[model samples]
Target: MNTQTLEKLREKLHDNANILGNLLVETFHYIGLFAIGAVTAWAGALTCWEMLHQGTITVDDILLLFIYLELGAMVGIYFKTNHMPVRFLIYVGITALTRYLISDVSHHHRPDMGAVYISAAILLLALAVLVVRYASSRFPSSNTPQGANATDDPERAEP
Candidate 1:
């Protein structure tokens, strides 16, 4: 009935709304990640099966499978630590470019600039991965607010 009681009730209601919103967001996030992971794994399996049924699997097919695998791994890491490793993406890029190079060479009877460009891309991606690794280690994020890397000792990161 008093102004103080009314103010307390309003604050409580606001706090409850925020909690409910956060809970809903987290639930949806998990659901989406699970769905994506399941579908990617299924597709990878299906592709492998189709390749086997066709009676031949090339190196490019194998590399394509690795992309699917990396995607699944990225999803798993997200589920486990809620942090996506940038390195995984870089690895996928490298694999994809290598596959492109293989495809161009196999499809074209003669060596072309397309294959050369793909090779260059792969090299650049590999170097980018190394640079990212160096930077992360050299200037590691000591304060992980989410506590995801709580066990990671910055001192042990020194090579």
Candidate 2:
């Protein structure tokens, strides 16, 4: 084919690909929602049973519950808003990792070095969370401004 024909064909292929990609994304989104519902129901049932039978809940168990809750909430938010809050996911990940470290510390007979390493990792993660929170607060997002827009600058509009 000639160059013009090839370009047109490529554009058509690109448009079709984009449409297919969007449809696949929507399908996966629905599948994810279904999976989240199933898993949340299962986890809620399990937690209730354990609470009733055990008569008490441990910190680790509570942490696990929070993880499940976060997962459910994240999925719900996606369904409602058609977007996921990445910051919330990061928080959930940090909580999960911290819970795992705490559980390991309580259950394991590892050496001091292992404990130190785990502590270091937790500290680093904590620092990361703090940095992200601070940066977001300071800069804000494009939709949300940190300060009022300048309306007194007509000359600056040309730039």
Candidate 3:
């Protein structure tokens, strides 16, 4: 009822909430890792089955397989590094889009719309990758020491 009591109660609630949020995050992290492992296993098995039965792998099929591999790799990297490499994922997405465009264009008589859309997506993803790479290089992280001449770090050498 008193202001001091209320403040203490609020702090306690805040602490409790933080603990609960952290637990939820950890739970989701584990779930994500498990799902990734399961999907990777399934994809591997499916690829093997297709290879055994069909005796031949097509370009489109290989591209789809690569998508699955990228997804699994992304998950693995997240588990190991605790961070996702956006640039690498963009590359994967570009490849997937290109592969889709190629496959669909071959089968359809007029793939103008699909081709344009896929091409635009590929271009946008490429731009994103370029931007991220440029930003990362220009403004390096703490582990990366900027040259002395760099305006951001006065202590570093210019050359």
Candidate 4:
């Protein structure tokens, strides 16, 4: 075969390889996401069952459920948009920290500095969420689609 024909064939092969690689990656990506969603749902269901068996709902249990809810929402949003919401993770962190703080205070007869530290951490996470929201709204990312959330795109996410 002539040099031009061989070059053309090589280019076509390269293009096809790239397409196949992208398809493979996308397939695995979706499968992993579905697995995560399933696990979250299963865990949440088990937690609910345990709560029902106990016959009493505690504050900690409610907070745990909220954490699970946030995780499920995060997973669903990521599955739908192909982007993770940073705010949901922050909300989870805040909820988890609040739960810990409450549990510690109730368990311990005397309050300690650890509780204060956890409160501070929750405040920081809340501030982070606010900052992210403000930045996304004030300066929409160029790579983000029109009318879409800028924060949803990792490229537009704050460092």
lDDT of 1 by residue, 1-159 (tens): 999999999999999999999999999999999999999989899989999999999998899899999889888777876777787888889998888877878888788787777888888998988887777766666555444452453222221
Candidate ordering by lDDT (highest first): 4, 1, 3, 2
Q: Per-prediction TM-score, please?
A: 0.84, 0.65, 0.70, 0.88
Worst 10 residues of 3 by lDDT: 150-159
Q: Write the per-residue lDDT of candidate 4 for residues 1-159, one digit (tens) a residue.
A: 999999999999999999999999999998988898888889889989999999988899899989988888888777777777788888899999999998998888677899889988999998998897788678776657787755466534553
Q: Which candidate number has the best TM-score?
A: 4
Quote the lDDT for 159 in model 2.
Answer: 12
Stretches off by above 4 angstroms in model 2 are: 1-21, 109-111, 138-159
TM-score of model number 1? 0.84
6-31 in candidate 3: lDDT tens per residue? 99999999999999999999899989
Stretches > 4 Å off in candidate 4: 147-159
Better of 3 and 4 by TM-score: 4
lDDT tens string, model 2, 50-149?
A: 9879999778888888878877777776776565656556667777877877788788856467767767776877787677666655555555434634
> Where is the poorest 10-residue window by lDDT in model 1?
150-159
Clash-forming residue pairs, model 4:
none
Q: Residue 90 of model 1: what lDDT? A: 86
Clash number for every model?
Answer: 0, 0, 4, 0
Q: lDDT of each prediction vs. the true structure?
A: 0.80, 0.71, 0.75, 0.84
